[model samples]
Target: MTDQPLPGAYWRLWFAAAISNLGDGVFVIALSLLATRITDSPLSIGLIATFATIPWMLFALPVGVIIDRVDRRKVLVIADLSRGVLVGGLAVVAAFWDVQIWMLWLLAFGLGVGEVFFDNGAQTILPAIVPRDQLERANGYFSAAEVTTNTFLGMPLGGALIAFAVWLPFGVDAASFVVAALLAASLRGSFRPTNSVPSTGMIDDMRGGLRWLLGHRLLRTLALVVTVMNLAFATTQATFVLFAQQELHISDNAFGPLLAVIGAGSLLGGIIGGKVVGLFGRRASMLTAALTPVFTSTAIALWPVTWFVIAMITVQAFATTVGSILSVSLRQQIVPGQLFGRVNSIYRWFSTGAMPLGALLGGVLATAFGLRAPYFAAAALLLIASLLVATGLTNAALSAALTQYSPVTTEPTFATDVDTEDHDTDDTPVSIDRDPLDDLLAGP
Candidate 1:
């Protein structure tokens, strides 16, 4: 059967996620500035950043259970609405009263908590709205929008809003949350499974989810790789603003274009992810994607503040996007329907946990070695990161599995999966017959 069009509810979720991500990006700019204004210490900024991320590390698994148990639409609506109010409060504090550094940490924590639910709901709800066949394209576009909002728009817009008034982005951000809330609440279809029995306890469910995630060897390896990548990503993020300003002499004006280039690359990469996934097959793409980040991040560290880093990162973003989208979509595709949420949580927890540590470490290292040194460290980590990913695919667990489970190599899995589902819709490179994992892990 032809994949039916995405239902109205799914559209609402997509739009809501997009807008909410945009607002989050703007608020990040505001928070960083607030930290700087309050205390000039890199350590303080790192601490605030750590707080903002700590919730992700702490609450991801619990949040997944909540998302799975509740009406996802409602959970999304609540998250959006709550964020709107929280941000609005920040705006008022910034505009009408003096806001403390601790308050910034509080706000960041609240936002991060809200994000746990929002993300869990978003990832789970999509499968309910669209046919299994169309999930990749949907994921690709969704991933692109996220990159656009977080990496591309968050700082630049935040900076711009701060220029107009430090409080303005928060106000606008609050308003965006309201829009997102309304959008989320307006979705029509019910997403919860019909089974009357729900998990009895939060802790039990969390452990069950974690067990399933870690028990699976392939997924467990992938999670470890994700953790390393996240650390690299967080470290770069912690240093980027300072690096841009100090090394490249990138003013507020120049930063936007530099980021925009990366976003554009992501957009292109997103559009083409499905084709690549189909051609390279999921395993190869994941390895490539993991490795590509190292190159760009290393380039960022090695190159003095020049147009070169921007150009390199832009190219890097597209390659990185291809790898990431493929990796995520592949993980989702292979995960059993029942275990998807928890597995994602497991992946998330590992990845998210790395952020705070990376940011904190970046600050410490930067202080000692200087701004450029962190990038060098990050680059070396990324090269090691690539090896970690390569090891994951070749591991004993995947080796036994891939040898027995041969994909239809001749016609291409992408042709079958895509033709039946999203013919001509995806730009991802996919070749059905070739399994990179199988190549190395040819088995017993």
Candidate 2:
């Protein structure tokens, strides 16, 4: 397919993501700093990160069901508004006096709840806004915007803002959410699933989503791999500040620029990610992406120098962005629209949800061993995950799965033999093909 510009609605959504992530990037740095200010312990920092991520494990299924049943635009609006008010309120509070760690933990949890809905809605609506062929490009646009705002502007600016006033970053974060909400409201057309069946009970709906994922061999294995990788990644998130401060001797004032460099790497990756995927092909691209963190983490662990670590992070960001563009585009193209939210949530429930555990592990490992220990541990875990992908995710396997996949259709059953109920709202009848790879990929 020839490359074409994405539709206006998609760009609107893209703009909204850019705005929101810009604030989110600032919020990440600000939050980490706030935690460090309140308590210098690694576990305290881990707790902050855990509160932000564990919501995915707790609410992914329900949020997915909600995204499927409602107009996705409304979901985005609500998420943005709620987050704006909540974080904005925190800013107001912090302006008066020193904020407490307990308060940060609570606010982080609340923001995470909003993210569960917002992120699911954001992913679910992409196929509706853009055609299947442009998915990689569309995703590339979104990733670029996200990394730029969340990392490039947000990270360094956050550090600077904190230096100006501790509460300033939070205020900026609140404003970004408000702007994002407005952008989301301008998007036209219905985003609800056209082929979704009536409620088969929340449990059944949730079960159906999980079963659909399990029925797809490649999808299932990928989700598991994402989970393990996320766990390793989170270790860095939870303790990177301490590592930079203690191990590398970077001062607080300069930390933001260093963090911002990570975003700079990701930004470059996002801009060229689709091209990389095209040149490398899916399997090779994905393998490279999977192994990237392994090598980067190892370099940081072994060398622990400032310049070397920065270079590795840039390479890691670039590789992961390419992989994400290819993988997310494939999933969006193949999964039925009605089931996309739920399936994507299930996908995230594994991939994103595992971060809390990793964060906790980072704290524990750092406490028991040393700050550098988490990097060593992360490298080890990532190496094993990469090896798994190299052995299991072959090109033939991906091609076979892609061959059997189609957009979600109104059918009596999904990828498995699970019974499906028809709704009067369905647009057309479609059935998902069950590949024999299910048995092999899903494991015994």
TM-score of each: 0.83, 0.89
Candidate 1 Cα outliers beyond 4 Å, as residue runs: 1-13, 147-156, 394-444
Native-structure RMSD, model 2: 7.7
Tens digits of per-residue lDDT for model 2, 204-300: 8989999999998888878877777778888876888888888889988888788778667667777877777777787887888888888898888
Give the Å error, residue 34, model 2: 1.9
Whole-model lDDT, candidate 2? 0.73
lDDT of all predictions, in order shown?
0.64, 0.73
Clashes of each: 20, 3
Worst 10 residues of 2 by lDDT: 435-444
Give Cα distance to truth, residue 371, candidate 2, Å: 0.9
